[model samples]
Target: MIKVGIVGGTGYTGVELLRLLALHPHAKVCAVTSRKEAGMRVDAMYPSLRGYTDVVFSTPEDAGLGECDVVFFATPNGIAMGEARALLDAGVRVIDLAADFRIGNVAEWEAWYGMRHASPELVAEAVYGLPEVNREAICGARLVANPGCYPTAVQLGFLPLIQSDAIALDSLIADCKSGVSGAGRKAEVSSLLAEAGDSFKAYGVAGHRHLPEIRQGLSRVAGEPVGLTFVPHLTPMIRGIHATLYARLVRDVDLQDVFESRYANERFVDVLPAGSHPETRSVRGGNLCRIAVHRPQGGDTVVVLSVIDNLVKGAAGQAVQNMNLMFGFAEDAGLGIVPLQP
Candidate 1:
């Protein structure tokens, strides 16, 4: 069994990882760290994990993480870079579910995340953990940087277009809306139910942190810098991200066939039938991105809709997928969950 250690096991992403790993056949939870919640049973804090995990939260110093086969940092951005190097040196594979090593340019990452990167040297070595884009790299990587929730949905939506050079690169747009859980399990006035509930508005219109990460990923895929307008909105729901992507066609190509053929073999990315509108709820609680393609009146503009459970495919589930690849397990081993429905 692959012994696993998790840092910052109190947040939504941490518990989501625990919940998913509990069902994984070849993985075992060896330790979970939380400075504030040390000594508390993980299952006690998150009852959903009650019968699945008996691991207790401990301080990072006492977690014995060096002995685990792999360690997942579900902590905030700055936390991972400060600690991943040590773990990697000890022969433990590291997966950071934060922005610490996602961006290739250190100065650019610092400007957006607003912190001096703790381990900039490792940034170049850390593989970006978007399985669809970096599967081979992740397989051989000792350190993996998991993509953010918004970037996951947006990049996946525009991937086929960019790869095929079918879209006007300079005019790409990602209009995304995500559930409240995307903010993380923290107390803030903006995230309060009283304030965010019953409201539909966009934030980070000027520029958001995920913008550069999305651009970086797409640019790498397109082999050139692509102009993109990424705007993210906070929805009233609790999970999932719906990204409505737009791009002008540079050439005539079957939009449906393009998306379908691109993701036909991908187990997690579902390309719905032509003219279908995928709902966020369809991917809720599962590591799946359901997409649909359309052309308005056979116009030059193409609209692609992509949906994913922000905490699942957008975060924890994708991390698990990377772990599976790194360790040579089935990609869908622990992620075969059916989406939750009303």
Candidate 2:
């Protein structure tokens, strides 16, 4: 079995890692670290974990994380960079579910995240862990930087069009909305239920952190710098992200066929039928990204709609997908989670 350790197992993504790893046939949660919740039984803090596993949380200094085959950092953005190097030096592969080692340009990452990178030397070596685009690189990576949630939804929606050169690279727009849970398990005034409920408003219209990451990913696929306007909104729900992407059609091509063919063999990306709209709830609680392509009135504009659980395909689950690839397991191992519904 793949012995695994999770850093910061008290947040939404941390607990999520525990949830999925518990059901994995070839993996075991050897350790989970949380200074605040140290010594607490896993199932006790999150009753949902009841009847699943009985591992107890440990403080990072005492977790003996070097003994594990892999370590997942589900902590805040800066936390992973501080500890990833030590674990990697100990022969433990690291997967950071944060923005620590994602952007290749060190200065750019620091400017946006507002902190100096702890291990800039490893940034170039750290593979951006989007299995759909960096699968081969992840297979041999010592450290994998998991992509941000918004970037995941936006990039997947625009990949086919950009790769085919069917759309104007400079004229791309991604209007995305995510559930409140994407804010993490925090008690901020903005995230309070009474404050965020009954409200639907865009917060990052001027520019979002996900903008650079999305442009970086899409640019790689398009082989050129892409000009994109990415705006993110907070919805009243608890999970999922819905991205409505728009791009001008500069070339004539079958849009639906392009989307379908691009994701044909990709098990996690489901391209819905033509004219069908994908719902955020349809992908909730699962490691699936459902998409649909459209052309209204046969105009020069093409729209792609994509949806995925902000915490699943958007965060913890995708991290697991990368771990599977790095360890030679099926890409979907421990990630064939069915979406939760009413």
How many angstroms is residue 150 displaced in model 2 relative to the true structure, after the best TM-score fit? 0.5
Worst-scoring 10-residue span by lDDT in model 2:
204-213
lDDT of 1: 0.95
Task: Give each model's whole-structure lDDT.
Answer: 0.95, 0.92
Question: Which pairs clash in model 1?
Answer: none
Name the regions of candidate 2 deviating beyond 4 angstroms. Answer: none
Clashing pairs in 2: none
Per-residue error at 167 for model 1, in Å?
A: 0.8
Error of 2 at 183 (Å): 0.6
Candidate 2 lDDT by residue in tens digits, 1-342: 989999989999989998899899899998999899899999999999999988999999899899999999998889988888899999999999999988999999898889988889999899999988889999999899998999999999999998898988888999999999999997899999899999999997887778888888998888889999988999999999999999999989999899989999999999999999999989989999999999999999999999999898999999999999999999999998789885
Q: Tell how far residue 143 is off in model 1, in angstroms.
A: 0.3
Task: Give the per-residue lDDT digits (tens) of candidate 1, residues 1-342.
Answer: 999999999999999999899989999999999999999999889988878989999999999999999999999879999999899989999999989999999999999999999899999999999999889999999999999999999999999998888999999999999999999998989999999999989999999999999999999999999999999999999998999999999899989999999999999999999999999989989999999999999999999999999999999999999999999999998999999996
Score candidate 1 by TM-score against the native.
Answer: 0.99
